[model samples]
Structures are given as C-alpha cells and as structure tokens.
Target: MSGVFQRISSIWREFCKRRAYGALIHPDGIAAQAEELARLADLALRSTAALSALECRHLAQLAQSMRQLRETAHSPEFCRLSADRRLALHRQLLTAREKLLASLQKTQISTEKLQ
Candidate 1:
C-alpha cells in the first residue's frame, strides 16, 4: 500500500477501537443530569400531595432545575425521543411549575387581602 493508504487504514482502526470502548467510559454528566431530573420528579410529586413550607422549597428548587434541564435538552448532545414522550415530559414539568407559581400568587393575594 502507498503511504496515504497506510495512514488511512491506521486511522480507521483507531476509530473502531474507540467506538468499541466508548460505552465503558464514564458518562458522569449524563448520570448527574438523570439524578437531578429524578430529584425534580420526586419534588414535583411531593408538591402535589403536600402544601407545607418544605414542599414549597422543593418546588422552587425543582423549578430552577427544570429551567436548567430545559437548557440541557437543547444541547447538541441531547437526543430527542419520540414526540409523545417528549411532549408528556414537557407538559408535566410545565404544569408543575405553573401550579407552584399560581399557588404562591394566590397565597400572596390572600395575605394582601387580609392586611
């Protein structure tokens, strides 16, 4: 083989090797994001069932993480799932965020009315 052909073959072999081992590499960022999303999901659930101050704190944190999650979803590395699942998750997060905000607003209005 000529010099260019030799270099091309060597590069192709290296790429294949990396692909074979890529899954074994730690995907810490993906894991971290999944953990965060799981936390937010739990908080969203808690908020729906309880109206205590702690639930409010969790909801606030979830809202902030959700904004970050939305940003992460837009990244090039993120893959879009089926349309149905994507829309479902989006609706869940948005509904939770809005619900929390509306409840807070109502509480504020009631407090103002009493004062």
Candidate 2:
C-alpha cells in the first residue's frame, strides 16, 4: 500500500538523519552534558584554586565543541527533526539552563567559604 511505503520511507529518512547528525539527534543527553560542563566551568571560575595546564587545554577543547553545537543549531540539518522532537529539545535546553543557574549558586556558596 502507498501508506505503508510512505511510513517506511519516513523511517529510513529519520534513520539517515540520525546517523548523519548524531550529535543533534539526542538533545536530552547533549543538554545534560552541556549543563554539567557549564557547572564545572563556573566552579573553576569561582574557586580560588588554579587550573592545571591540562585542565585549561580540556576547557579549550570543550569551547570548540560548544561552538560546533551552536553552529549546527543554525544548520538545515538541525531543522529536519519533527516538531515534537524540536520542542523537546527546546524544553530540555531551558531545563538545562535552569540547572546551570542553580549550580552557580551552589558553587558560589562553597567557594565563599574558601575565601
């Protein structure tokens, strides 16, 4: 039937997209990792401790990856997701932002004790 063919086509297209854009496909996991990285960055900035050379290099690498994610968000490939998936990504981003903000407060509290 034509309907069955269309469903199969859709599935194939989605699979291809997922393969091609693996980073953007799992927005929930990506958002969580981003939030955690941001929290660590915040802690580093707030703490009196100095960062080792390796830690600085790692943060530089993370900055480049974050920039790639920003660029990908503007690409047509990022728009290929279904509306529900896009909405879920948006919601996850918002949740991640809130968590990052909460983490900043905790980091501040702990760092203040060290000062």
Candidate 3:
C-alpha cells in the first residue's frame, strides 16, 4: 500500500511538471500570459487609491517585468531561447499577475472599509 501511494505521488509530480512546461511553452501561451499580466497591472494602477511606499515600488517592478516579458517573448530572438529561459519568463509573468491581483483586492477591501 505504501509503495502504491509513492507511485501515485511520483506520477502526479511528473504530470504537473509536464503540464506546466507545456502550458507555458506552447505557441500562444507566453504571449497571452504577458498580455494578461499587463492588463492586471494597468487595472491595479488605475483603480487603486493611494498605495503604500512598498506597493508603489512593487507596482513599478511589476510594470518593468511586464514590459520585459512582452519584448522578450515577442522578439525575433525569442524562438532561439532555451526552454528553461522561456519557462522562467512565463513564471515571472504569472507571479506578477498574481501579485497585482492581490494588491488590487487589498486596496478594494480597504476602500470599502473606509466607506
């Protein structure tokens, strides 16, 4: 029974790894993620009230990352990039997107509380 459980866990890990790789490296995947991240950042910047110093810095960093991701992923040189490089960029975009979302939610919650 223990052996069976170990096998299942191993299989699950492999599946997740492959899925993550494929999803990020597929033809349209990287570009789409970059666009989504940009949209989120824009929304957060436009809708939020006064941000903290840390939030402002984070938002600046996220904007820079989004621009870099867009340029790299869409460049003619992108096709020559290694799978690892593309995957890393995709991960960065995803992380930025999540952070922007969280920031936006926090701002909204605070605004509501003040109301």
- What tens digits encode model 1's per-residue C-alpha lDDT throughout 74-112? 465544333333445555655664665566554422222
lDDT of candidate model 3 versus the reference: 0.70
Question: How far out, in Å, is residue 114 in model 2?
Answer: 13
- TM for every model, in the order presented, reads 0.39, 0.43, 0.60
Best by lDDT: 3
Model 3 Cα lDDT, one tens digit per residue, 13-77? 75665576876775368877876777776667666777777776776677667667666766778
Compared to the true structure, candidate 3 yields what TM-score? 0.60
* Residue runs of model 2 more than 4 Å from their true location after superposition: 1-65, 109-115
The candidate scoring highest on TM-score is 3
Worst 10 contiguous positions by lDDT, candidate 2: 106-115
Per-residue lDDT value at 15 in model 1: 62
lDDT scores of the candidates, listed in order: 0.53, 0.58, 0.70
What TM-score would you give candidate 2 relative to the actual structure? Answer: 0.43
The residue pairs in collision within model 1 are none
